[model samples]
Every structure is written in C-alpha cells, then in structure tokens.
Target: MLRQYELLERVRAYDPDADEALINRAYVFSMKAHGSQKRASGDPYYSHPIEVAGILTDLRLDDETIATAILHDTIEDTVATPEEVERLFGPNVARLVDGVTKLSKIEAQSENQRAAENLRKFLLAMSGDIRVLLVKLADRLHNMRTLHFIANAEKRRRIARETMDIYAPLAERIGMYEFMTEMQTLAFRELEPDAYQSISKRLEQLHKGGGDLIDRIGRGIRAHLEASGIEAQVQGREKHPYSIWRKMAERHVSFEQLSDVMAFRAIVGTEEDCYRTLGLIHGRWPMVPGRFKDFISTPKRNGYKSLHTSVIHDEQMRIEIQIRTGDMHAQAEHGLAAHWAYKEGKDEAARTQHPWISDLVEILDHAGSAEELLEHTRMAMYQDRIFAFTPKGELIQLPKGASPVDFAYAVHTDLGDQTVGAKVNGRVMPLRTPLDNGDQVEILVSKAQHPQPTWLNFVVTGKAKAKIRRFVKSKEREETIALGRKLFDEIVQRLPVPLGWEAIAEALRRLHLHDDDALMEAIALKRIDDVQVMEALLPGSAGKGQVKPPPQRQAISIKGLTPGVAFTLAECCHPIPGDRIVGLRREGTGIEVHAIGCDRLADGIDADWVDLAWGNESDGGTARLCIVIKNEPGSLAVITSILGNHGANIVSLDQKARDGSFHTFTLGLEVHDVPHLMRILAALRATEVVSTAERI
Candidate 1:
C-alpha cells in the first residue's frame, strides 16, 4: 500500500495544484473504514484500495479521481456511506466512488446477471463522467492481478471470464491498450491454463535462443532513421503470449507457422517525421503485400492513430513496425485519457468526444434482459470497425460485417426505422450488403417505410438491433392483439348466447386478465383455450366436467395473420389433426407449428409459443411414413398398388437405406387425419413386400 505522504507526492509530481489535504483526508478515511478487514490473500484490505489509487497516479489523473479510487470500495465493502464520503470529499469524488461501487441489492439470478447489471449501471455513470470508468478499470485490473489468491476454482474462473469478456474489451474501447493487454494476459492465463503455459514456454525458449535480437533490430531501425536525418525513439519487444495465442487462434496457424512475432515502434518528433520514418523503413525493406494499415490518416473509432506495417528484412525475417509522433504515441497508449486534463480539471469536452459511451447507455434502455444487454454490448465493443460515409460526407462507423441497416441506425435511429433501400458507391445495392472501409453509402428512406423483421437477419450493430427489435416487439403486440380480437368475435359467435359486456368482463376476471384486450391476446396467443374462454364467459357453456376434443365442426380456426407472416408445420414432429400443437413464432421467419411435447420445443424457448388448432374446414395434409420392404423385383410395384387401393397418395419419397434384401423408405403421404394414415400403415404391414411399417 502506498503511504499517505508518498501518494500525495506522486500526485503533486503530476499536478502541483493537486489538493494534498483532500488526498490525505481520503487516505485516512479509507484506512480507518477498512480497519482489520482482510482480503482472500490475507492482506490488509486497505492495501487493495490504495493500490488502485496508486494505479491512477500512473495515469496522472486529478486529485479527486485518485481519491475516488482510494475510497471506491469503501461504500460497498465497508460501513462507510456515500453521504459520509461526500461530506469528507466533494460531490464529484463521492459520485465517482459510488459509480465504481458494485450494486449489492441486485436480485441474484446468476453471476452473469449480476455482472451484466453491474456493467449496465457503470456504463450509465460513465456517460456522465468517464473517470468512473477509469477508476473501475483500475479496480478490475488490481483484482485480476490478485485473483489467484481466491481458493475456490469456480469463483476464480467466473471472475476471470467476466474480466476477459467485459473489462478487457472495455479497456480496449477507451484505448487503454496497456491495461487491456495486462488484463487479457491475466485472464487468458486463468481461462486457458494449458494453452497459456505452452505459449509461455515457447516464448521463453525463443528468448533463450535469440540473444539481443530485439535490441539489435530496434537499434538498427533507430540508426536508419538517424541516417535519414530524422530524430526518433524506437522500442522493440516480443508480442505478449496472449496476443500471440490470439493471433494463432484467429488465423488457425501453429507456433511454427507464425512469423513477425516481434513488433517495433518508432516514435518520432512530428507527424511529418512519423511518415518520413515510415518511408525510410519501407524504402530499405521489401514491404509485405496487404499487411499495412494507416490508422494515422483515418484514426480508429476510439481515436487511436498509428501507421502499422509489416516488412520482410534481408535475413528472410518478417517483422512488424508502427510509426507515430510522440503525441500520437501518448494518445495511442492512454487513448481517450490522453486528452483528459489533469492540471486544470477541464476534460468534459474530451469526454463528450466518446459518443460510444452514450450509445452503450442507450442500449441499457432497450435490451430485453441482462444477458441480452451483455450480448449486445459485446457485439458493440468486440469487433473490428468499418468506416462508411453518408452521401453528404458524414462518417458512420460500424462493426466490420455491418449492413446498410446498421449504418442507418449508427447515423440515426429514426433513419434506420425508415430505411427502404440503399446505394453503395453511387450504385443500387442490396440492403444486406456488407460495407467496406471508406465506402460512400446512401440510405433511401420513405415516410411509408418501417423496420422489417427481415432486416434483423442482416443488421450488425447493437443499436440497430435494439431499435429494430423494439419496433418488431411493439408491432407484434399490437398486431397480435388485433388478431386476438378477430378470433374473439369468431369464437363468441359460435356460442349459443351472445357475449354481452357483462359476460366479457366476467371472462377477463376468471381468466386473470386485465381487460378484454388481455383476454383476446391470451386467446390469440393460445395461452387460453377457446373452450376455456367459453367456460369463463358462461360457466359450463363448454359442456360438463371435461371439455371434449375438437370434432370436425368444432375445430379451431386460424385466421388474420399479417400479410408477410407465414405459418408452417414443423418438419420434426410431423403433427396431424387430433394431436395437440403449438407454433414457435420467431421474427423474420414463419410460425412453425410443432406437436406438443416434442423435444425440439425445448430449444425454441427464445421463440414465442402460440397454441394452435386445425381449422374446422381444411384440405388433407402430409404425414411421414417409415417403411421396410423386401428388395425384390416388382416389390416397388406392390407398394404403389397397395397405396392406390388404400387411397393414400405419396406426396414425397425419400429412401433411407438400400442394404442387401431390404429397402427402407421414408415417405410423406397425403391423408385426411391420423386415423386415415394409420389405415395405410396397416395395409402396408399386411403385405409380405412390406416387412415393417410405421409413422415417422
């Protein structure tokens, strides 16, 4: 733990105007609040907070941020209150500390839910003040560093996975590459111990074999730059084991296949010098094809700027290099924090430049569940970005595989909802076209246009998905309720007595629905049986103790589905009349009807389930048959003759096996109902050509 005087001196070194008294007081308050507390490592708990504070000092953060870091855990882990912290420190520090504090009151769903909710809260907090994120990142970093001290293996893995999935990516979003790299390294070690150990051992062996290789190359580059009359500082190091392993995984290559494992950086005095350095290096070596990225000219979405390239040196060695000015280097290292002012405490404008924080905050509102929030945010954070521009030259950044719908939403949510078509690079293009970097995109919208369920299949950005989903959900409910009303009138007309307002009101009460609309929706969604609704409207109206199965005239009718909405029978269950059925309703796809109790229904939990019954008037449908017949000459003729005699028409034919003396055929038969299909099976079984017969 950093001593009080030492921590103050470190802060003063960065900003002489830092409030020493405030820092001293926060240190004392945190220390006493955490007195006698111990961590899983059996270290004094105060050490954790102070260590986090020490980390902020390295970033040259302001006094208030450092103090917030020191007291961040006090509110959650100790008896110290936010009000008390505000009294001691100012409101800014107190708010920052509170933002970093984990929410203990979240209902326990699982670790994932808790992590997602916690992520949701801090993302909102970071929208107002980024210092909360900075402190939170530091806190996570320190905890990850000490994670091995925890005894429980499952608990350790959960924390490590959360850090890898959420925190590391978050750190990357802010351009805190060092923090992101360190956290990823630690998390990778815990998550994939064997892979981590193998990569580490390989790297160590390379280090032992190659003495001064990194230094020699770095000095050689600096010498070349000096000879070209350019002043520069060059850095060279092997890539971190995690970075190496990730590249291997992504490229599907082995360690022996990997080249350019070492990277060198040339930090120069000016932007011109940075480019000049790049020219000098490329002029001296054979530049690799398609292995160059000029982020300096077009910076990343996170404001990272650098010119990266890979070159083949004369030794048959492939090496990667990055060139940047000193300012660019600092910006690349510290990311958004580089412009965060520490001396004057005036970085609010810098914080405003990060619109992604607000975008994430907006996602918090529309996400359906905690897991969904995490999924969407991960989709937002963890992807290589493609930059597309509007016809008016406004830039829109989206994930690499983003379609025009994603581009429209990234530009504005309203535009996405109204998008009808798009033109990429002055030519008409499909809406599902994946955007390339620097492409000019024109979104064509009309007032009549609204989001379609089909767009969800192609859209990539989280914002587009959330907006499109909201529109779909709202439209689905409204349309479903309308369909319910139509069904309600049809069912009511069948009753012997008219459904008066009094009867309808009593039906809603008996069905535990809020109103007629709720009851209608329930009936339409198949949550309530039509017979049940009749019984509720008038006791015993559905007949005596038990409701009878649907007779031909009493079969339920399905009608009024939206024009584009399709209803199809599920292939898995081969459902027929007299079998209970339900429809799995997924947006952009048909309502797939499945037999009740089919194993496939379990996987459709994410899809909407609607109870369905056959219409009173209908044509015959197909039922599948599995048959085994002797593979003799004229055996096929006997099967066709038997089918013709039984009045069963083969709709489709698929043979499963033709081994030796037997042929196993899977056939779809046109039939009126289950009993009619059973008769065909009996007829086939009675013949010697058909050794065995059964419904599939």
Candidate 2:
C-alpha cells in the first residue's frame, strides 16, 4: 500500500507542478474501480496500476501520462467508463484509457490474430500520443515479470510469443533498448526454456568476474575522459540473455565466440564532446575495422542518434563502446516521447514539427481493414528496419527483407503501380531484390506495365501488398465493366426488345450482386449462364423456376455381366454405357467392354472374342470419342450443333491441334442407346475433315 503523496513526490521531480489532487483522485478512483479484484498472483489488482504508474514516472512522463497509467486497467478489469475518466482527468487521459481498454476486449479467432490485433491497437494508440504505447509497454513488462503466477503452459507460451513478435520489436523501434532487451530475454526464456537456460548458464559462468571487469573499464574510460578535460559519464552494461542466445543462433556460434558481451556507454554534454570521447576511446584501444557506425549524422528513423564502435581492450579481449551526448542519450531511451512537450502545444504546429508522427496517425486512420491495419502496424513498429536510400539520397526505413517493390510502394502508390523494374546501386535488379543498409535504389516505372499476381508472392511489406491489390482490383473492375458493356451489346443485338444497361443492372442487383463488373466477371467465369440473363430480361419467363433437365437414361445392360467383375473400357475404342456394347469374357475376372469398331478388336485380340449380347437396361455413363475437324472458327459450334441435334450430351471436350489447319477433339458424351451412339459416330465420321471418329 504505497501512499499517493510518495507517488506524487516522485512524479513532481520531473513535472514541477505535478497535479497531486488529480493523482490522488485517480488513485482513489482506481482503487474503488478495482475493489476486491485480484491478479493471477492473488495480489490486489490496484497494485498493478500503481506499478504501471511507477514505470511511467521513472520514464519522467508528464502528470497526465502518469494519471492515464493509473486508469489504464480500470476500464478493462473493472466497471469504469471513459466518460468518468474524461470528467475526472481529461480527454487525453480518457483516450489513453480507452485505447488500452479496447486492446483488452478484442476477441480474435486464433492466437495469431489475437497477437496481431493487440499489436494493431497498440500502434493505433501509440500513433496518437506515443505515450499510450509507453504506458502499455510498461504494463506488459510488469505482466511478464509476474508471468510465472499463471499456471497454464499454453497461456504462458502465447504471452511470450506475443511479446517476442510485437512488444519486443516495438521496444527496439522506439529506442527503448533496455526495455526491449528485458522483454526479449523474458520472452525467450518462456518460449524456449531449455535453450534459454543453457545459454543463460553459460553466460553467467563466462562472466563470473564480469562485474569487476566492467567497473575497471568504466573507471578507466571515465578517468581518461576527465584527464582529456572532456566531461562524460561512462557506464558498463552487459548484453541481455536473449541477445546472447540470438547471437549464438544467428551466427551458429558457442558462447565463447561472443567476446564483446559487455559494452560501455559514454554520455557527454555536446555532439563535439561525443566525437571527442570517441577519438579518445579509439586512441586508447585498437578500433575493430568495419565495426563503427556513426548514427549521429544520420539518425535512425526512431530518432536514435549515437556513435558506436567495437575495439579490442587487450590482445585477447573485445569490447563495444557507445558515445552519445546527454540529449542523444535521452532521445535514445525515450524516443518519440522526448517530443511530447512540443506535441502538447498548438496542434497544427505539433503536426508540422513531427510530420512523421502525422504520417503514423494517417496510417492508423486510412487503414482500410483490420487485418491490413494490423499488418502495417507490425511492419512499421515491431520489425527490424533496413535503412536504404533513394537515388536522390533520401533515406527510407523499411522492414528487414523489404524488396525494391516495397520501396517503390513506400515512395508512392502511383509509382508502385507503374513500377516496371528497379536498379540497386546502379545495377539492374529484379523487383523482388532485397534491400540492404546504405544501398541506393532506383525504381523504373512504366505506364504500360502493371502489377502481376506473382508480385504478391515476393513482396514482404503490407503497404506494397495493399497497393498492388488495389491496382489489380481497379484494373480488373475496369476490364470487367468493358466486358460487361460488350456482353450487353451482344445480348441486345440478339434479343427482340432493346434492353438498356439499367435493366441489366437491376437484374444483377436482384441476384444480390452490386455492379455490372461483378455480373460480367461471373458470366466470363461461366458461373452465371448467359441464358439466365436473357430470361431475366424477358417478362414472366418460363425458364425462371425451371431446373436443369436430367440426362435421359438408356435402359440397356450387357448380358452375363456378373457383379464384382472388373471391366475396363478400351482406350483405343471407348464404349459408352448407352452404346451398342459387346463384352469379351476373358479366362479370369478381367473383362473387356468395347464399342463395335474398337481398333484393337479389329486387329484381333490375343484371346478369342466371346459372343456377348446387350441387356435391355443401360447404366448411365460416358464414352470417349476422338473427332478430327477443320481448324476454323465456329468449328466447335458446328460440332456442338451436331451433338445437340442428336440430343447427345457432351460431358467433357478437349481439343488439340494435330498439324496445320487440322484439329482433334477427344469428346466425352452420354448417348441414349447403342444405336443412338452409333448413329452419332457415323454422322461425325461423314463430316468434313473427319479423318477419324472412334470410341476411345
């Protein structure tokens, strides 16, 4: 039971005119709202919110942020209203509470969706103030710290997976390195307990004397800086447990391979002092080649600016050193929140100052669907970013493994829609080429070229997928509309009445369809019958309630066809069940059924053909027949006309070209009887360019 005065005192250290009355009111309201509620650990639920507030206070968040933290869990876990929060605190506090509250009520169908939705909500809230996410992150950190109280292994793993996938990366994106490392370590411990323990034990054993070593290094760096009259604060920090485990897995190395497990941060007062400290450190130790990064000049997208270098402290020892000014250090730890003071002022001015903040807000606003919003949020907030450059040298930050297609889309939807090809570092590369750090990319655009379905297979970023989908759908809609107009024209030409587009639109709307394009696309796919549209246009149509006529069955069966007998239709000459069929009874269960002109039998079977007659009843079946026809337009129409005249049903028809100006159609059809089938085959054989008509 921590007192409200104590909390206010801590908050007042950061915000001089800290609202004690408001803080106490929130504390009392939260206490009442969470009355008799308990956590998984069976502690008073109020304690959780207190801890969350304490976390925000440590971050030196403003009074409103601290108040919001107190009320964050109230709406979710207790009977508290956003209105009440707004009345008690303000709209800002209420919005934060509402943001956190929405995340608690999302009922995703699967664990993956659950995680994605949570991340989406977090991002939406963060995009608004950025403080909401900071509070939420603090909340998650506390939950993770006490996760062991939850007995279920599956629940534990789910929480851990969500933390790893969303929270940890988000922490990194915002430059909360300490929180990110802590969350990752906890998540890794839960997700892969055995591996975590193995690596953690090794790290502990290896760094047995690490505390003293870190103290000595810190002191030495501080003394060297002081001697050089450079004001700086140097502190040593070890790599988190999860980081070590990840390094081992990524590099496929044992713990011993990781030499620079501990790092020293040199915090100075000015940018010049930072560089001076870096020089002094380099002069003291041999700097490792290709191991230095100057983020000061080119700050990270998250506003993290620092200079990093790795060096060998001794012949056998490697260490990392980070040099940054006090402002840079604050920016590194607090990220976008450092700009909170500016944001709290004039709204228009705030938007102009941090335009990227507004970009984030727009991303939240213009997200068309929940899934898309979730995907964009994850990529933008919770993934490792690769910083690439446009040909103009403007830096673009994208998720790791983002393709040139992603970059094209990031530049503009119109550019992405027109992108035909891309060049990386002056070399022509595929659109799917992955960007690396510091690489310059140039996208080639063409109005003639459009996105292909295959682009979805490689594009990694959500924005790229959304733009491609939008472009493709727009083109498809246009094409379908055109096709629909053409189809309508053909329909009107063939019909007696002059039907207009509105009438067709009405008919389609009756079928629960929205527009002409949808109806036209359905017609093109053969999903909607052309005759159905004609019937709809005509008044009191007889075909409206009519069902498809069942195939007329021929009552003919082969005699002496025993049950449990296996029979095969000859490929050389296929026999339909309705065709005049003859069965050759072999010595065993294997029997051969064929149409009269089976070429294999004409050549003569290896065994003697037995005299078998047909029964009166014929089973419903189809036979394969190959027909040769003149390769000309409407040749298929002529063939279909012949079948329709005979009332023969064509099941499947496949045609392939035999040579120049000649084609072969392998026809599958149902005939009423053997005589009917025979007559049809005879008629096909007599047709022009009919090289052969055989049952096969």
Candidate 3:
C-alpha cells in the first residue's frame, strides 16, 4: 500500500499542478472510512484503494481521477454518502465517485443482468466524464491483480468472465493496451486453467531453450537499421500466452506450426523514419505477403499509429515487427492515458469527442432491455475494424465483415431506415454485400422504404439492428392499436348501452393491463380477445353470446364485426389469410371484406369500414398463381405433380393465355399463408416445363 505522502509525491512528480492537500485528505479519508475492513486477500481494505490510486498515477491522470480511485468504494461498501464526499472533496471528485458508486449498487436477478446494469450505469457516467470509466478501470485492474486470493472458485471464475467480457474490452477501447493485456491474461488463467497452464509451460520451455535469442535478434535488427542509416531502438520478446493461445485456437495450428510467435518493435524518432524502417526491413528480409499494414497513414479510432509487418529472419524463422515513432509508441501502449498526459493547452472538449461514446449513449436510448444493451454494446466494442468511405470521401470505420446496411446506419439512422439499395465503388451491389477496407459506398434510399425485418438477418452492427427493431416494433404497435380500437368499438356497439373511455379504464384492472394503450395493444395482438374485453367491460356478458367451437374442427373467427354483421370475402382480389383485409358495411347488405391493397378497394365504394385481421385460428386460405408453361400434355401433368408434392390442394385451374409453344394458366390452391404460396411458386418456377410463376 502506498503511504499518503508517497502517493502525493508520485502525482506531483508527473503533474506539477496536482493538488497536494486534496490528495492527503482523500488518502486519509479512505483509510478511515474503510476502518477495520479487510479484503478477501486478508489485507486492510484501504490497501486496495491505495494500490488503485498508485496505478492511476502510472497513467498520469489528473488529481480528481486519482482521488476518485481512492474513494470509489466508500459509498458502496461503507456508510459514507455521496453528499459527505462532496462536502469533503468538492464536486469533481464527488461526481466521479458517484459514477463508480452507482455501478456498484446495481443488483439484478441474474449474472447477465447484473453485468448489464452495471455496464449501463458505467456507460452513462462515462458519457459525462470519461474519468468515471478511467477510475472504474483502475479499480477493476487492482481487483483482478489480487483475484487469486478469493477463495470461491465459482465466484472467481464469474468475476474473471465479466472482466474478460466487459472491462478488458473497455480498456482496449480507451487505448490502455497494458491494462487490457494484463486483465485478459489474469482472466484467461482463472477461466481456462488447463489451457493457460499448458501455454505457460510451453512459453517457459521456449524461453529456456532459446537463451539470449531475444537479445541476438534485437541486436541483428538494430545493426540492420543502423547499416541503412536509420537510427532506431529495437526490442523483441515472445507474445503473451493468451495471445498465442488465441492464435492457435483460431487457426487450429499446433504450437510448433506458429512461426511468428516472437514480435519485435523498432522505436524511431519520426513518422517518416517509421515507414523508412519498414521499407528497409522488408528490403533486407523476405517479406510475408498479406502480412503488412501501415497504420501510420490511417490510425486506429483510438489514435494508435504504427507500421506492422511479418518477415522471415535468418531464412527460417518468421517474426512480426512493428515500427513507430516514440510518441506513437507511448499512445499505442497507454491510449487514452497518453492522450490526457499531454493534453495541456488543447481544449478539454477534445477529450470527450470519441465517436463511440456518443454511439454508446444512442444505444442506451434504443436498447429494450439490460441484456440487449449488453449484447449490443459488446458487439459495438469488440470487432476487428475496417475503414470504408462515403462517395464524398468522408471516412466510415466499421467492424470487419460489416455490410452496407451497417455502413448506412453508421452514417445516420434515417439513411438506414430509408435504404433500398447500395452501390459499392460506383457499381450496384446487393444490400448484404460486405464492405471492404477503403471501399467507397453510396447508399440509395427512398422515402417509401423502411427497414425490413429481414435486414436483421445480415446486419453485423448492433446500431443497425437496434434501429431496425425499434422501427419494426413501433410499426407493429401502431397496427395493433388500430385493430384493437376497431375491435373495441364493435364490441361496445353490441352492448346494451354504448361505453366510452371511462368504461375501458374501469375494465383495465380486471384484465391485468397497465392502461388503455396496453389493453388495446393486447387486443390488437390477439392476446386478449373481444369476449375477454366484453367480460371486463360488462360482467357476465361474455358467456351470453360466446359460441363455443365444435370439438372436432377449428374455425376462423372475426373480432371487429358484430355477431350478425355478415361479411363476405371479395372475389375480385381473393383476400387470403395473410392479406390485410378491411370490413365494409353497406345499407342492408351486411358487410363485404376486401384486401387493403386490392384494386377493388381503390374503387372508393362508399361504406362504413372497419379494420380487420384474421385471428390465430384462421389456418388456411386460397391463393391464385399465374404461371406460364410449355403448351404440352406432359407440361400440365408436371405442374399438377409439383403442386401435389408440395401439399397444395388445387381448387381450380383455367388457361388464361396461350402462344405458339406456351400457355398461361391461373390456378387456385389452398395455402396456409403467404409463405406457403411463395414456396409453391418457387417449386413451380424450378420445374423444367415452367417458364414463369408468380402470385396474382
């Protein structure tokens, strides 16, 4: 544990303007607040906060961030309140401590929910001041470092999994490679003891066998750079066990098959030298094709820059090399920490300008549940990135394997909603086409088009899927409300006396609904039927008119039309089970139902109309298929054979048109829904004698 004065001196050494008195007060206050409490490791609880504070000093964070780290657990595990912390430490430290405190207080029924709630709170705070995430990460790092001290194996593994799934990705997002790597290693050990041990033993054996190999390789790389008039410092080492293990698992390769396990870094003085060093190395050694990347030209979203390549050294050993300037090296290792370290004179507003932060906030608004937020945020955080561009040259960074729909969503939600087609590099492509690095994408959108539920099948980004789901859900709710309102009106008209909104409000409690909207939505969704609503509205009235279905057969029931309203399906368009049909009442003529989009409906027949839908019991309907086939006896037989094989019962068949060698026929068949009709059509189209097949 760091002493009060040592912690203060450490902060002062890096930040001369750090508040000494503030640090001392925080250090003493945390220790006193913890009192006699001890960690699972049997050390004084205060020691944990002190160690976390020490870690923040290594990042060279501001004084408030460091102080917040010291007092993060005060409100969570102790009697100390946020009000008291604010009175003692001022608002800045109090706010950060409050953020961390909220993250700790979220308890849920399941482990997944708990993690999601905690992450939700953390992200909310992170949006305000990224320092909240910084302090929380430091706290998580210290806990991970002492994780083995915890006695329960299951508890330790759960903590390790959460750390791996959430915290480590966050650290990497903020550009803290050092913390990310160490946290991953610690978690990997707890989660996969056997694999971790095997890899650890292999690394140790390699280290012993290749005595001074790292040194010799470093010297040779340095000598080569110097010989080419490039002054660079070369460092080499074996990759981390977790990284090596991941490579083996991903490629399904044995340890012996891994050639580029050893990596070297050449720290140069200038950006120009970084690339020159890359060229010189590639010129000297046989370069591994498709293994080089130049991040110096286009840095990562976190602002990391480097030149990476794999080369064959000594004509046998394949090694990976990275070249970067000194400043780039610091940022690559520390990420956001390095950004803050030298952020003097630069506007503080620049710190919170990360595009992902706003994206997280948007996700919070759009996510429907804690699990959804967790899944979407994880998808957003963890991905190998690829950079695409708009036709206007604006850069759009996306996860590798992302489709154009993902690209459209990244541009704007409206664009994604209205997207109908896409062009990749001036050539029209399918909407599901995966975007490649540096490709220019132009999305073609139309106001008439909205996100299709099928878009969820191929979109890789959470943002696109979230927006699409929200839209689809909203549209469904609107349609459901419309149907429910029509049903409610019809039910009321059948009553002894007409009921109003107050009557429905009175019935809400009996039906276990939240409010009128919920009740109506339920009615629209068919979860609650006309009989149930009438029973709720007028007690014992439902049993009077309810006609129980006969035992042997299931029959379709209409809800919005009164019991004796008498409705007939219009024959002009042949409204089916899946079609949106509406009820039209004419004077003394009961009612006529027509598909909403039917050309017959466009005739503007004047009548009292109500929205209608087929109930869940409505199983089968007839559909008409207009198909073209060769005008031969065997062709008609083949068509009939295909329909019978697909279980379509043909109701009627008529020859609509004929040519020299082909005939057009309109056939009516009983189908379950639009999908059944589509399958039948597809099967007919696949037949050798059929020229075309389409739904009428």
- lDDT string, candidate 1, 31-114, tens digits: 899999999999899999899989888888888888888898889878999899998898988877776774323312486454
Question: Could you tell which candidate, 2 or 3, scores higher by TM-score?
Answer: 3
Q: How do the predictions measure up, each by TM-score?
A: 0.55, 0.55, 0.57
Q: What total of clashing residue pairs does each candidate reach? A: 0, 13, 0
Worst 10 residues of 2 by lDDT: 547-556
Off by over 4 Å in 3: 107-112, 115-118, 342-696
User: Residue-wise lDDT of candidate 3 within 429-530, one digit each (tens)?
Assistant: 999898875577899999999888778889998899899889767765665565566556666665655566677777998998887778867765557666
TM-score for predicted model 3 compared with the true structure: 0.57
Clashes of 2: 13
- Stretches of candidate 1 above 4 Å error? 102-109, 112-118, 344-696
Question: lDDT values of the candidates?
Answer: 0.77, 0.71, 0.77
Query: Could you tell which candidate, 1 or 2, scores higher by lDDT?
Result: 1
Residue-level lDDT of model 2, residues 368-424, one tens digit each, is 443443333333443355656565444465777888888888888888878889989
Model 2 TM-score is 0.55
The candidate maximizing TM-score is: 3
